[model samples]
Target: MDRQLAERLEIFERTGQVAPEICRFVRTELDVLDAAGSEITEESAGTLTSHLLLALQRSRDGGALTEFAADETVRAELAGHPDALEQAAALAERAESALDVVLPGQEVRFLALHLALLRQREAMR
Candidate 1:
């Protein structure tokens, strides 16, 4: 894990904003991404990390988003990047297994959008 991300996770754990299991799950996900050849940096993964944390917290609290209206334009954009969508779905599945929580399809789509955007940014650089 990146030092900055580890520190951030520590802060969240210390502040009681994130459960230890959630932190561990995030760390494991980062490791998985790293092993898959994706650059796991604070800048590249900060938003994704935050989103995963919040999603896990919400799941634990039983406060899932009732409806997630993904923008059609964004969905269309993501549709062009099937690899990202597949990766996101795989990650979501792992999260479900690791955290023992079900992530709604909308949440999965949002995760895919983040990944697609990240891939686009990386390609530009």
Candidate 2:
């Protein structure tokens, strides 16, 4: 995930505008996921599922890194539906597992946000 963020940060850094907002959001999300990963078992699978769905939607809204043209291979892979979502969800699940073990009693508000975002994306689609 850090690798993915590094790649995205590099792209946004080149854009020279909206860098702060994008950087902050991406970094925060990464931090939350990292925290979740560190203590996942306490989290519910449904929560992780929700987060994956929302993340997919947010990815769509934030341009999803799917339109760069230069990274057709990555785009195609992500566009393959379940494959990308599954991989991302798996990561979230791992994070949830970690969160459960270390940060027990935590709420998955982000997951819910992700789900809502995904639903909006689907409606638009």
Candidate 3:
């Protein structure tokens, strides 16, 4: 296991309330971010991890956030960054498979935004 993942798992285990599956899901996303060299800030990681875990829990509970529709403004903005859009779509596909839930385009756009923001942060650094 990656050191980061091991450390994260340790923390999750200490929480005593996290399900093993949730930890696996979080670890998967963290691994993906690490593999892509995306270094999100600790705050971002905490927020993203919480959201991802909640999403997975909802999926498992048969109550996915299915009503979040992407507006044209979001689509238009994402169109400006074709690469980010494409990468996000691909990542969303993997996330769907991993979570066994079909995320709405808005959720996928959120993922793109996350990646774009992370990349922008890296560029700023």
Candidate 4:
């Protein structure tokens, strides 16, 4: 396991809590992903986009989404909007690519898992 992920898991094990904002984001994203198992209408797409924007904001501010975490809803929305998908894919790919620089190879599996989840989410689209 990645050290960072391991540490995070430990922290959760010990504290039984994550940042409130992160928890909210994760729950919302996961619910959206679960909802993706059905049709992704325009209204759903708008909701997904709103959540992604929120996730992006959190990420930009150095907050982690380890608690709730983003899911496949992002990809589903992208499928609905090709242009937006392209933009989001680019941004996500960039983030994935930069993981090594960001973490210096410590617990890299955690990063891979994150990217994999994002890919799974995208695949839903």
Best by TM-score: 1
Q: Where in model 1 is the C-alpha error above 4 Å?
A: none
Top candidate, metric lDDT: 1
Residue pairs clashing in model 1 are none
Residue-by-residue lDDT tens digits, candidate 1, 1-125: 58987787788788998899988888888888778667777788888888888777787788765476655665787779899889888987887888887777667777788788777777777
In candidate 1, how many Å is residue 2 off? 2.4
- Clashing pairs in model 4? 2-107, 26-68, 26-69, 72-121
Give candidate 4 regions above 4 Å deviation.
1-42, 69-91, 95-125
User: Each prediction's Cα lDDT score?
Assistant: 0.79, 0.39, 0.64, 0.40
What is the alpha-carbon lDDT of model 4 when measured against the actual structure? 0.40
Go through the candidates in order and give the clash count of each.
0, 15, 0, 4
Candidate 1 Cα lDDT to native: 0.79
Please give the lDDT score for candidate 3.
0.64
- Mind giving the per-residue lDDT tens digits that candidate 2 earns over 1-125? 43544555445446653344444444455555446452222132334433333343344345332233334444343453543345345544554453321111112223333333343444464
Encode model 3's per-residue lDDT on 28-124: one tens digit a residue: 7677776777764454455555555555556666676666555566778776667776776786677677666665666667666666666677677
Q: Give the per-residue lDDT of model 4 (tens digit) for 64-115.
A: 3644234455444344455434434544554445431122121122233433
TM-score for each candidate, following the candidate numbering: 0.87, 0.28, 0.67, 0.27
Q: Which stretches of candidate 2 lie over 4 Å from their true place?
A: 38-125
Model 3 TM-score (2 dp): 0.67
lDDT for model 2: 0.39
Rank the models by lDDT, top first: 1, 3, 4, 2
How big is the positional error of residue 87 in model 4, measured in Å on the Cα after superposition? 12
